[model samples]
Target: MAESNKNGATARLRNYFLAGVLITAPISITFWLTWRVITFIDDRITPIIPPQWNPESYLPFGVPGLGLIVALVALTLIGFLAAGYLGRVTMRIGERIVARVPVIRSVYSWTKQVFETVLSQSSAAFREVVLIEYPRPGCWAVGFITGTTVGEVQRLTAATVYNVFVPATPNPTTGFLLFVPKEDVHHLDLTVEEGIKLVISGGIVVPDQANFEGAEVDAAAKAQVAAQSDRAENVEGNGRKRRRRKQTQEPRSPGFITRLRNYFFAGILVTAPIAITVWLAWEFVAFVDGTVTPYIPAPWNPETYLPFSIPGLGVVIVVLGLIMIGFLTAGFVGRSLVSASERLLARMPVIRSLYSAVKQIFETVLKEQSRAFREVILFEYPRKNCWALGFITGPAEGGIQELTPDDTVNVFLPTTPNPTSGFLLFLPRRETQILSMTVEEGIKMVVSGGIVTPPDREVGDAAEPEESTPAPLAKSG
Candidate 1:
């Protein structure tokens, strides 16, 4: 009895341990990630910031986190300006000036275009998530649809166009972008978050509830069989010849060893979900810590809070704080910061070049939050038959079209697996079919390389048709 009690206690303790591990890992990992990103930004600022003006000089604390604060304030002020009319005028003036400068103008406008596409609310880019086939046959991935094909190519050759982004497995941020025709790309039923989880797990995670239900049904059926056998045995012992005859007619009862094996296996099937969940969660925590924690300074040791840190708390707090400041700058505190940054950057010649380059990229990509990567679509490119993912930006407007004497639309085509690079093609509108899919779906398909096929009407095709009710002809008469 004592041995049995001890074993029970050990089992309970193990369960408790597993539960704790499952809960705390995600929180600690998030904090570690936030800290690492902050530190990286500080490292970049450290080399450029003079020792006297540096926030570190004034603080006794190890590596000040105020640079992140500065970035937040700056962003907020920029948001405020961008939201208002005066800000637009200033931005236009800056654009006009940049356009006049030869080398700087080319780099500035290109960088600006990318940012505008991504940040502007009108850009409508990366709005929808999708699935696509990727890497090899039978493999699928999640992606987003950015936009459509554009430019003189459209006048020359009318085609239905799309831009698909196929995200990398385990890392959705990096992936391929294929511009294909609208007809070839199919939409998936899975949500972006679910798709990401599937990719990261490499298809190991199954979400079908039917499997569990079926297992339950099988177990219940086996239980019913055992119950029937018990009743038959009882009847035989209770009565005489008739009962003995009835028992003989029934099938043979299962052996004790076989019954025991079935029961044990059933128990395992029931607990397998909980066991696997605990194991995966533990592994996830370990992986995040291994990847992000080492980059953090020793002083912020996350292990101290082990088993509980508030999941994604770091990301939540930091992002919220930044956004809040942005909201405030849209009011007042934000404006002052932007003016200061602009003035400071404008004063130095060499610093101006570097600052402008980085600032331009940030403004276009992160500042205005343009609609560059709004819709993901499939666009046929290079030839009549092939297709790839392309983002639909605005219609092309340039002197090149005036020179061509033919109507043309412009489109930017991004490279796949690494969206940062790709071809820029001009194609006609008639050839392109605007997809029913949202921008997010197109990206997943592109990034996944066509692996993640989104569910369609066919998934429900197995269900039997229901009988229709007879028409009320008698009432009409």
Candidate 2:
């Protein structure tokens, strides 16, 4: 009886320890990560200040977040300068210099455009969350409305289409672009942040159903039923067809070995996504550390003074360097230097052509006025009865529009699973059907291969036809 009591006490103690860990682990980890980021920024930025100007130099101890404040002030000052006429001229001169460098032009142009688009307040990159039926009529998935289809795509179809971005589970960064019909897409009340959380958590962190005010329960039920019936019919038909081919053949049950193998594979499917995500994050940090640490001067390097090596200091230094360069480039003297460098690069023969082509491509894609990949659409490809997903790149340019007597648009039809590689199609305005779903939903469909579907809604008689553009759905603020 004494031994039993002792064992129970030990078990209770173990449980208490586990409970403490459960409660404290998340909070501890969160603060640790935050501290690391703050420390990295502070270490990189603090050294740039002169000893007399530095707060740490006079203070008894170092202060946290001081470097972050300094960085913010520096950026604000740079922006104030860039808003002036001299800053504008300086920026233009610097751009010209970068444009003349063959290899550096491509990198700088793309990087600049990406920053502008992401940072622009007016740009609608991923604002409106939505739902769309993808792969087939019954299946649905969440999407983000990028913008409306424009140029040749709108003219050829004679209808408006929405550009949808469909992000995949686990990794929402990589996904497909789908052009869905405007009336067909069901707008969701959930915010983009909520949608991203749902996707990253693989539906575990679902948004409240009550928030989906526009969702039609009856329509979703009917669509789900229809989908199940269609799947059942297809399975039944396939079974019958297979039976007809061999009269005496009967389906055999799987052996123990086969069952074991299947279970093992199923286990792998459950674990692979999580494993890959963690591994990729670690590799990215390691790569940044490996590449950036070598460039750091020994005297200024954090590792020189510290007993242990810091992984993210190099990344912090790179960020600070970019900010400093932006600050310097906005000034008058920097503009003169940039102009001189540009002239030197322009004198080079073979490098100029390569630089020009790359610079032009970046300008076209990054320009706020450009409508490339802004809208999504659907059209018959190869032949009738077979539909293909595509993004409206822009109006047919060069000799293509002139060569074709009828109005035509350029559509990029991305391949399934991998959206980066796809066919480019030129079709008439009457041939395509524009969709309302966001590009994000379309991407998820392509990545998931029809497994992740959007919510469904009833298409009433009042629904707009393929030829007509539907009215925009009211979006939540």
Candidate 3:
């Protein structure tokens, strides 16, 4: 009896261990991968930054993401400049200089074209999803309709052809581009987003056909498959008969294994964002600690005396130092010293520009927080019917408003993935639509490229129905 009881307990213990692994393994792996990437980037990028300019120079330890921040600011400044007429002319001249190098020019132009096509919002790349027979007649693949075959390729083909991109499993960014006849391409009843998710998941998570009712795309796909199957039968050359294709008729319901795989993926989906966020937060803390710790006298430093070092102790010290400085600056002596120092720096030829620019940026970001980015608005930009998300800086002041046809407001249109650089426009007040969402939410939406959407405000049912809903565009800015 005792032996049986022990066996049961052992079985229960094994199951509990398995359950614990199922819960914690994903979280652990995600954290490990994120740490690896952060350290990797830090190792490479930290050394590139100059010591005088780098925050790490003042600190005892290395700063993660400092190099990245510098690179970001530099790129954003370049982009902001590039939006102007002079910058375009300069860019052209720079391109011409680069074109002089044979190998380098070829690489530059090719890569530039690829980025422009992929990143440009106006391009119709990956807007439509289709299925095409790849590798052989028996095998099939998911592909995106990039566009029509242009110029030489179109002329060579007898029938209308399309540029279909067949992306590899788990990585949709890399793909094979093929020019297939329009009739040969099978249209799937799947949205481009769903198709991408399918490709990224390697066919584990399938979209339900029932959701898209009365869609003729599936019929077209079915006909195309039937024709291909018949063609395969007719093309048999040897005595051995080719097997009829199954799995082509209809997609089967996901079984137990598929469900378990999907659940595993869901765990990853939950863990990944959390892991990345934690890593970034830790990097920031470490960066601040590194920047502040070195300034502390060895006798006063806790880490110097203590057996175990404390993380974020430097952050606390730095915060206290800032408060002290602020308090001192409130007095006459501190103000006089700051002014005198600034005047001296302004007298220097090279240091003046850098000092002024940095000071201006700090003042704009810190002092003018209440005035800047007060409201989120949408206005027509680039062309009519096309709208852009912009933050309302304020009413157009000075000579700028005098020239406009109507009363205007200054709007700061931020660039996506990087919001530091963008176009500033004086838009007519009536043309812009004010949104109820907060500036923080708007910024999040812009930074995430519409992936992070702010929920709509609740409206009364008594109100009249609107004609159409406004959506944030998938543009670069």
lDDT of each: 0.52, 0.64, 0.62
> Candidate 3: misplaced stretches above 4 Å?
1-256, 368-370, 395-404, 458-477
The local lDDT score (0 to 100) that residue 231 gets in candidate 2 is: 69
lDDT (Cα, tens digit) per residue for candidate 3, span 299-378: 99989979997888887998899999999999999999999999999899999999999886577556755456878876
lDDT of 1 by residue, 1-477 (tens): 999999999999999999998898878888899989999867755667677877677787656566765555444555545546886687678667756866445334333334334443444245445444444324444556565443222222236544556666676676555544444334444445665666677777655543222111234554654454456556644665776788789858879765554444433332333344445555666666565555555466565566665444344445666898889789766798988988998999999899889886566555455645554445565444445557765444576556543444455676554455666655565545555445554443443333222222223322221111111110000
Shift of residue 288 alpha carbon in model 3, Å: 1.5
**lDDT against true structure, model 1:** 0.52
Cα deviation at 102, candidate 2, in Å, is 3.9
TM-score for each prediction?
0.39, 0.46, 0.46
Clashing pairs in 3: none
Residue 103 miss distance in model 1 (angstroms): 6.4
Residue 284, model 3: lDDT of 77
RMSD, candidate 2, Å: 22.4
lDDT of 1 at 66: 62
In model 3, where is the ten-residue run with the lowest total lDDT? 468-477
Clashes of each: 107, 30, 0
| Best of the two (1, 3) by lDDT | 3
